[model samples]
Target: RHDKLAVNYMAMVKLAMIQQHLRAISPSDRT
Candidate 1:
């Protein structure tokens, strides 16, 4: 459904944002 696609997109965006935040918080320690 269209709603399901939208939810998936949002989840991906949130994940990307979290990753960026983590990178900014720690640039040396990567795992």
Candidate 2:
């Protein structure tokens, strides 16, 4: 049970990181 929770947390963290990276990159292309 604990392992499953850890995996889920890691997946969420990676997803958030990817989203943040996309947001960080998009503004530079506008200029």
Candidate 3:
């Protein structure tokens, strides 16, 4: 159970990082 939770946490963290990177890049692309 602990291992599963850790995997989920890591996945979420990676997803958040990707989302933040996309958001950062998108604005530059618009202009």
Candidate 4:
């Protein structure tokens, strides 16, 4: 369904955003 796809897409986007935020705040965590 289109609505379900949209919800999944939003969730993925939010997850990516949080990941980016964490990475930006802690660059030394990659090790």
Candidate 5:
């Protein structure tokens, strides 16, 4: 159970990073 939670946390962090990267490349292409 703890491992599952950790995996979810990491996934969210990665997703946030990707979003930030995309915004940096195109500030006007936000959804």
Candidate 6:
């Protein structure tokens, strides 16, 4: 159970990082 929770937490962190990266890049492209 503990391992599963850790894996889920890591996945969430990775997703957040990817989202932030995309948001950062998209604004520059718009202008």
Best by lDDT: 4
Find the number of clashing residue pairs for candidate 4: 0
lDDT of 6 by residue, 1-31 (tens): 6999999999999999998999897877666
lDDT accuracy of residue 9 in candidate 5? 97
Q: Rate the local accuracy (lDDT) of all candidates.
A: 0.94, 0.91, 0.92, 0.97, 0.94, 0.91
**Number of clashes recorded per candidate:** 0, 0, 0, 0, 0, 0
User: What TM-score do all the candidates reach, one by one?
Assistant: 0.81, 0.75, 0.77, 0.79, 0.77, 0.76
lDDT tens readout by residue for model 4, 1-31: 6999999999999999999999999999978
Clashing pairs in 2: none
Residue-wise C-alpha lDDT for candidate 2, range 1-31, written one tens digit per residue: 6999999999999999998899897877656
Which model, 1 or 3, shows the larger lDDT?
1
Query: In model 1, which runs have C-alpha deviations exceeding 4 angstroms?
Result: none
Model 5 stretches with alpha carbons more than 4 Å out: none
Candidate 5 residue-wise lDDT at 3: 100
Best by TM-score: 1
How would you encode candidate 3's per-residue C-alpha lDDT over 1-31 as one tens digit per residue? 6999999999999999998899897877666
Ranked candidates, highest lDDT first: 4, 5, 1, 3, 6, 2
Worst 10 residues of 5 by lDDT: 22-31
Q: What TM-score, to 2 decimals, does candidate 6 have?
A: 0.76
lDDT per residue (tens digit) for residues 1-31 in model 5: 6999999999999999999999999989856
Candidate 6 Cα lDDT to native: 0.91
By summed lDDT, the worst window of 10 consecutive residues in model 1 runs over: 22-31
Which of the two candidates, 2 or 4, achieves a greater lDDT against the reference?
A: 4
Per-residue lDDT tens digits of candidate 1, residues 1-31? 6999999999999999999999999998666
lDDT of model number 1: 0.94
